[model samples]
Target: MTAAGLPMEIRSEGLPTRVRIHEVGARDGLQNERTVVPTEVKAEFIHRLAAAGLPTVEATSFVHPKWVPQLADAEQLFPLLGDLDPQRLPVLVPNERGLDRALALGARRIAVFGSATESFAKANLNRTVDEALAMFAPVITRAKDAGVEVRGYLSMCFGDPWEGPVPVAQTVRVCRALLDLGCDELSLGDTIGVATPGHVQTLLAALNEAGVPTSRIGVHFHDTYGQALANTFAALQHGITTIDASAGGLGGCPYAKSATGNLATEDLVWMLHGLGIETGVDLDRLTATSVWMAEALGRPSPSRTLRALSHKE
Candidate 1:
């Protein structure tokens, strides 16, 4: 049986033996950081992550400089990462303008972020849920026509800071919208880090009942309230194989003050490795990378695994 008391046959059936970790420390992790990390440093971070065996690394976002000044060097950053697989570096594109910038720079993969709750949509994107999806529709089509893959991110899928408990149907509707708009994948985000394992299973079950393939979905969990690992375990039991993580737990929602950083990559890796799951990431190297970044940030990583292993480092 799974840790949550889920029956082994039920939770383990069709379970994937390997999980894909989508590294977002370069983009999402650093975007909210107070200091504007040097462009060269950011490029090196990406390269180091690839060398450490991360298959997919979110390099940076193409949002306007004014919106996220930390990633203002997206143009310069893209060219520096030419040595890495273009498809592995997915840049966040806010709209056609952002997508245009990435396409001009020859980026092959892009991600568009949206919200499941109306309050967050208006606050984060200054648009209603439908309006945001409408804007992404054309962007998805243009990217697809250009042979680029688009990934959709829906935040506040579990609980919104302002809206309290978000109904599952609301999140499901947004999930279907993104998929219908030609997105190849949808990442459900617990933006405020309020999700429990039960909530995760229920939502995934709802999405499954709605005929959304688990293969097309990914989970993005925040570490606040100390529930990130528990939530991730629930996602795994449901056969979810694509997990989003930030090395050193290096990001926070700019709009959600109650939220903390993402589920730490080291913490997730510890759990997956113990479960005999293959992630192709060297634990020692990954922990050292987090430590190196912690020093750069002038603090320490929020990852418990990293902390527990720091003595050896």
Candidate 2:
């Protein structure tokens, strides 16, 4: 361990050789913003992310405009991403209605949202835990039949804002349902960011015991408790390679006011690259894009890497 007491990234072993970062800045990152970003600007931001070589960018959500006003123009925004590879741009779909809208617009890849805790499911989706999974069942099946790949999101895997700590078995059960519904992959989200390294390791180990392969799971973390990176490191050491991050640390959960933004892509890239793990991201170009995006948002980026690098210019 370093003098700072942080776990050092081991170059020789116990680390992934490559990591696939699922970029969520354009969708989850911007969804709750109070300011209305122009549809074209949102499109351009995604374009920049793709150009920076993000493997998968959550482009937009097909949820009702009344719920998330910021991304109300999903229809308009999706058309702008026509030039990007279809698989690289996945849109969030709450149910069949959202799924139909996305499919009508040529979206081949989509994400179905669920929750591990009943409190968050009720507050966010207005449905109980079982009800939410019931809702996602048909959505996931229909999407798969349409030749559209489905990625599942299970929020509040670690803890919930309304309900305190979530049980690992509850998380595993929810994840199993999503996968059984035929979701190609599942992103376990620490919606409130209350997860620590020990929590991360325990969760993954429990999921493994539940018969979920590490290859099919990705972790989405928030830096709210300042444990995102440490938790990610723990996950990596435990043989999980996929991670979800936002550019410039751009998103925060609307339900939790005290929570900070999602783990920053630049910050994750800095650590992964330093540890000799390949992510195929251009750090300099990505940093420039973050600076550009911060200017567009009319604020400095929250990424310490982006902040320090921005000052060097």
- Which candidate has the highest lDDT of all? 1
Model 1 ranges with Cα > 4 A deviation:
1-14
RMSD to the hidden true structure, all candidates:
4.2, 3.3
Q: Which tens-of-lDDT digit does each residue in 136-229 have in candidate 1?
A: 9899999999999999999999999999999999999999989989999999999999999999999999999998999999999998889999
Candidate 1 global lDDT: 0.91
lDDT by residue (1-313, candidate 2, tens digit) is: 2442223655748788999999999999998789999998898899999889899999999999999999899999899889988899999999999999999999999998888988778888999989998998889889999999999998899988777899888899999888888999999899879999999999999988988999999999999878999999999999998999999999987766656799999999889977979899988888888888889989988898888777766
All candidates' TM-scores? 0.95, 0.96
Error of 2 at 36 (Å): 0.4
